[model samples]
Target: MCGTIDLYYALTNKEEAKGILPNLRFVKETNRRDLHDYIMWHNINHLTKFLSKKYEDAYTPVLKVNNRENDNDLIWKKCLKMIPDFLQIPLSSLYLRYNIDPRDKIRVEEMADIIRDTYVKSFRQNAWMDEITKNNSIYKVHDMKFKIGYPQYILDPTEVDKDYEGKMEELPSHICYNQPSMGKRNRAYLFGAIGSIISYFISHSFNHPNREFKRNGVWESWLSNKSLEESFKELQNCYRDQYSKYWINDQQVDGIETIDANIADNSGIFMALQALKNRRDMNNVRYTSNSNITEDQLFFLAYAQARCSNETVTPPPTSPYKYRVNGVVSNLKEFSDAFSCSRGDPMNPPKKCTYWDF
Candidate 1:
């Protein structure tokens, strides 16, 4: 029931720019929204079919359903669960399936407690960062404003709708053709979109802070879970110490300085958590926030609970996210401080945590 059309419009035959591919049938049959949806469907179907063939080798192996009635179901579920692990999809995207009932504001406040206990304490224990850097890092956490829930402006439907207004619906055919692969691809896209949106909000949060800092002509920056890369780059030229050279992998053809930011991000979050924990313990702060205990423990539990499942496609043998978190944290003095581990704890093992100073 599908046919291709090659339509041409004659405006003085040779004297014409190009005519648009008018969806004449759509114009004749459907409403504006319906027509847009129809167009989107066709485009997606066309794309999936093209991709399925183009990357046939890559996907075909994953798509083969082992068995309909047996343990195959388990495998399918396992694969779906593993998506976040392999893809490193953000927590926001992964949460879409299960409704996160709005946490009690009391519980939400515990985030600050968790920050103080686990994250902050760990940072203070870090032997790597110098005293000045450690103190400044602590100050940053204390000064950080936690914006829970959607921003104040986004609560307005008009503004929210405008931000997401133009989404087109893909046709049923598109879904049917690429149902197997669509989930992963769509999830990936969702993460990317969310990342961009988050970056925007993080940027906005800094506008006022930057303006005030600018009065003194001093640049101020806010760190997010996502801005670890830029922060490292900022650190690059500012200090060149003995440890900086250690960060440069001697075996790597790419300069040690060129290591992926993910390593630094893992290191930073771990540091932040440790430092927060130290502050909490020394001050006897029971919560992760400015308030007391309401939900601080729950915030720390979230990390353990969030450990994603492994991939269905037997991932290249060893891509463990938890290990990455642990590996970097072990070398940090702040982590040991927050956890109060001796010089040789299993998880927070010792490493020459040297950062480049020059």
Candidate 2:
């Protein structure tokens, strides 16, 4: 059944892939290099957005506040204020290596798992979101799936082959060289980092059963108590609760769309904190803040501060990955306090911050 469904989906998706190939050929013939890059960029963007949206829906409220107030502005502003520590590039060399390491996929999957554990645990600890919301958020995350590295399996290789027809036959000789570096330090660093991330992930898996039980165990009982007909009605209502409003025109304001993955990470954490705060308030949990700011604003500012870094991209601002990760995280007060950011020079939010107090 799984194989048949996969095959059917593959065939259906291939038509769209093939349709784009002729345009790639056109770009090649026209000598328009930018067009080729644009196509590749959008193709990657679509995949990222699709995956992010799929997972994000279960965790976040779909309140799209910001046509005028986008997250990019906040991210960039925070990036500009970042220090050096949070912005350090421990894996720079490995990332730049671009060599086909056999363990690359395994390493990436491990990284995803590590990130999920850290962030999802934080989600559970948030003081703002309510019990039901926290439970739902955690449930969504505990059941969350990971698809690290590229979805090459989803790529129709035949369609890719069709695009390569009559293209350059001679591969770059420089890339084909079979030389292996003998530097032990560099080699150890690369392997060690990958191993460390994997170790963390493997250790976290042991705790998964408890997390799953907490979410599913109670919810399943409530859901199972109803008659079949009543259960179906509740299920239908739940679907409407989440997605029915998305179809209504003018439902939400405009927001910033960014190529930066870190922005989404920042926003996700911010919202989780907000939800935590709401939860805490409802539960009469005592909390104090010296910042004189709403948890919503502080959550966003924390996200912005996360992007703070001392590193600046030369004129054109290359390396969105580095900028998003190091720059943003460096600016947060929470991060700074944990890492000890100096007084009177904390991170700043965007000039036109669209405060999503939702």
Candidate 3:
């Protein structure tokens, strides 16, 4: 039975993947000399070290807020990121060696497993989403690919280097930004930095725009229940109102502007907590009781610290770091429970707006 259904989806999803194939498909890099031409345009010798080492580092490290006043450094970092598009293979090789490794996948994949399974439970509980959409969401989660670390072919740099012979064969774009999004500093703080941040990002693909795309990457509606759309809108409005009510940098948050992120933030937090809950002894993420923090609370601390920045609050596309931490935790009853907040307290609001609470 499972095999037959898989076959049917494969047949149906081909067209969807095919439609975008023209855009995503890469051609022989040896044939495309524009990249080389672009490189010669720059100070190639001066950038050699940057390209070889520092450029890759800028991308993999935990994101830091731009509090520094060095405009030149920012420009240099910006240039480093752009160069990867031109130096695909060389940079991929460098990235494989230092940024992340195949071994990192085992632990991160375990994290993905915990989050994905928790998402399944959330789907099962969503009464507003019809059976078809919910089931399809679950299916999509099951089928979701974790493009961990780098491409396997890159492991043999000499062999792939010979094959490319100085041209661009773009690896799948999906894997470009997937660094080792987990930290090893503390066990309880496992999700504190990289884990929940990446988990949040992965869940966003299933949120707004990518939500329209199927497990097969097709842009088609699977909302078997028509009212699901309206319900979603209402839920979005709740986020808008909720975030708007908060103040940031002496300016009010335009919930309308940050709605997508807010929605992702909401679901992401829920998923992170649920994922954390699923871990066996939370994988024994280490923390001494001297800190007076529980293992579960440490996860939230890690989650916030990953988003921590030194810059002042900025306007949306994202809420200020403060709101991203407090605004979110305020609505989570689990957060309240984790900290033993009294009802109606600031962090423990009387009313909550969790996505999967239903």
Candidate 4:
């Protein structure tokens, strides 16, 4: 019954599910027990019952895919549990061996300063936020801590080795070949620094008086201004309407579920781009190369590339990779300006859905 239904579904929905076929085939070919076990134990019973009842005549064809057992399957399954420890030991060892540190402390510190400065500037200039809230936001930015790269202690061989003292023999043979470099370290630092700034702002919004809070461990509305509250609702509604248009698996994405990630994606890219622009402006840097693209364009391109993925079979609850790039960039005036996109252009719509004032 399972085989018949599987073949029927694969044949009937082949076009609609084209992107997922390779994954299905890979699973079958590789004989992944974990995936097979999950499907058989959790999903197969319910799924088969539904299909058999719904389409009794659907069992016209049978799947011809070969399913051969691999000798290394047991070893692979065992290794999965130890993967974290296996990877971490070598990674930490490499970091220690090379004495990994922030590639450019001055540059990182400057970027951090720029990000904080930009946040404070946005807070001061925002008309929506009241004086008290804006002041509190600026204070938070000032107090925000920046832990850019690996801690200094990680560079010490003794300290790092102590973490895997008894499990030295468990270190895989692949560990000797793995080495950490400055590029990876720099990228990690950039992500960590940006992530910290973004997280702080997100937490600040929730705790803001404009939203609400608890006075006696019970939730209550602290927003005194009716106009501000209405504006907030309007902004939220705009986001909901905008995001609801996107479909995943034939179902519309819930805007509220995607709000947090959407906010992070949009704000993270914006803040990073702003920092880059600030740095370029301060350094008197101009696009001198004959690449026919400006630094601003490159900035957006880099951001999009970082998030690029073949989101063939993502669940409806999460925003697709393409949407993450498009949805965020479309609302960004800087992106439109950089590319000189027309008002009605897909990437530069005249009307944009915005949740954050910045």
Candidate 5:
């Protein structure tokens, strides 16, 4: 009886959810009637269109209104994307073998260790937190588990199919944008890019890096000390004020609104730079730049390149991509040194804000 009632409520909520969904994939300005028709046609023809543009008329306007840079993908690319729904593991495995080097697992694990060490060092040097809090932070990093890559067993399709419904697949979250092509990037940039992404995803998972809350089991925090709380707030204000002043397309960034992403952005860059510095490969010239560019310069360039885009989401919780690059780079003196900008220049302002001052 309860299961039947639960099913009835589930169906009812799903029907009610239509009031909110509105078939708006990427934009709100699309015509409702047009979208409704598109959905009806799409339900019938989406698969057939991959073989041939059988319903281009129904989909073209949605792309145009969404301001998509390219309205059409290659036939194979579309098919490849669509096939994942039916053949996820096999297709992903094939893509991994073809594009992602198996050795990237080693790269990711090594980078994760480097970032963890960097975090510990930063905690040790942190002048704001009391030793108690600082020690707890260090302990957390020490105990944190870093899972780097997919399981080797996944390569066996027969084993996967036996319990597919119960298993959660580990996959690359942002293969194209986050992991920039290694050949196009200098070593410093490559390390920075990979290290940044490693820390970026990790940061989002176990958030509030600055706060501690374990009171027992060898790791605990009150998070109630007035002085430490003040220090934490000061750290937040530093990034918040810095971002609040940045204007994009006449809209001032809502620093308070985007504080988490802003903090993650700064922390990612900091951790990545630290990881690069922590490596034994640092010969003061990690990458030989052909165009008189320094290694550190290449690192920042790669970070910016991966993030370079003009698109901004409506009611952005993060700054625009341009500002994300600008805001992060401007906070670090190393960025100014990397590019050799004058101190008073826009990119190298005299004042900067930092947290965990590594």
Candidate 6:
């Protein structure tokens, strides 16, 4: 019963989102509100039924009693929910079930190389950092690892099964099958991961030639120079003040709460722009055939389009998509030069936050 319902939700949602599967064609015209309502109803009804059952019986086995794997339906449904591919369902399932065969290996490698070079260049050119720190940063950038697409081991059935087994063992029994607790756990894990990245960058930045960088779990030792410390604090305060004015839940949210994500968003976009600028192919590319827009304009447009979503459904914890686009671009002098935006223009704000040299 639970398998049937789970498959139904997965298939229906995928079809609605992608307009795939001729049998599910009617869902293509379904209103977004109606779709949301249907999902909410489905969750309330089916999830309750599934969760009330004994844990062992809640999810049916992917194989039948005859020791044969259930045909493509179950696997397809699982693929729709688990995989990140945006292609047609069949192709996506094939990719997920097989080896991680990236079709754009050359392109991915090229972008990675550009990003690495840009980062190294930025580190070396940063005026604020000492010579020793700059050298250390360049060494670290050279040592950085890149994991593109999925891991190759996922293609092996035995390895995939073992991975799932390990995950199941690691999960707390009480929260493993509990939807709300599982969501909370996922959020906690995400926060911890992001926190670790931010902490590493901060600690590495402040590391002294005589002292080793240690993760004492507190940010108190992030800066030692009195003037530099004050500048850092001022930079943070700028972010806090700017982001605090943005509305969340019909009220202004405290900027400090969103600082980490904002920093990541800003830094991530800047690095991407740098990579795009460094690409040799982009030298002759234009935004459009007849439009006056430049390649940089198109780059920013692409970034904005990727982030575009229904703002009404966005959570309070997340910044509005407009802010994500505007906030990042506003801090970039490259953006100002590309569009010839004057310093006091809204897109070229005078008091922009510059956390790192980027």
lDDT of 5: 0.68
Assess every candidate by TM-score: 0.32, 0.29, 0.68, 0.60, 0.69, 0.53
**Regions of model 5 farther than 4 Å from truth:** 1-82, 161-185, 204-224, 280-286, 312-314
Worst 10 residues of 3 by lDDT: 62-71
As a whole number from 0 to 100, the lDDT of residue 322 in candidate 2 is 41
Residue lDDT tens for model 5, 107-142: 667778888888888878988877877777777667
**Ten-residue stretch with the least lDDT total in model 2:** 252-261
Q: Per-residue lDDT of 1-358 in model 6, one digit per residue for the tens? A: 3333443555457554343334354456776787678767666643432242353243346235547442234545855654433322333335555433344333445455666676677877777666655665566556655554445454455654564455423211111111122222222122222222323243233333212331233334333356755655666677778888777557665577666566656766666665555553456553344566555666666566656677732444446666777777788897798788998998898887765564
Residue-by-residue lDDT tens digits, candidate 2, 213-305: 334344232122235335334433432232222221333211122211223333334334433444455567554566555443444444444
Clashes of each: 52, 32, 7, 0, 4, 0
- What are the C-alpha RMSDs, in order, of all predicted structures? 16.0, 20.3, 12.0, 13.5, 8.4, 17.1
Q: In terms of TM-score, how similar is model 4 to the real structure?
A: 0.60
Which segments of model 1 are wrong by more than 4 Å? 1-258, 278-284, 287-305, 311-319, 334-350, 354-358
Q: Which ranges in model 2 have alpha carbons more than 4 Å from their true place?
A: 1-99, 150-327, 334-340, 346-358
Q: Which runs of model 4 end up more than 4 angstroms from their true locations? A: 1-91, 95-101, 104-110, 161-227, 355-358
Worst ten-residue run, lDDT, model 1?
170-179
Q: After superposition, how far is residue 54 of candidate 6 from its true place, in Å?
A: 10
Q: Rate the local accuracy (lDDT) of all candidates.
A: 0.37, 0.38, 0.69, 0.57, 0.68, 0.53
Rank by lDDT (best first): 3, 5, 4, 6, 2, 1
Model 1 Cα lDDT, one tens digit per residue, 1-358:
0244332222122333133333354445667786567556555542332343346444445445632221233546856766544433233323322433333322334434444334344446654455554555555545556554333333234543444454323111110111122222222122222222222232232233342232124454333323543554444333222123322123212222323332333333443344344445666744334444223233233333333445222122222344433444455564466466788676455543433221
Residue 280, model 1: Cα distance from true site in angstroms: 3.2
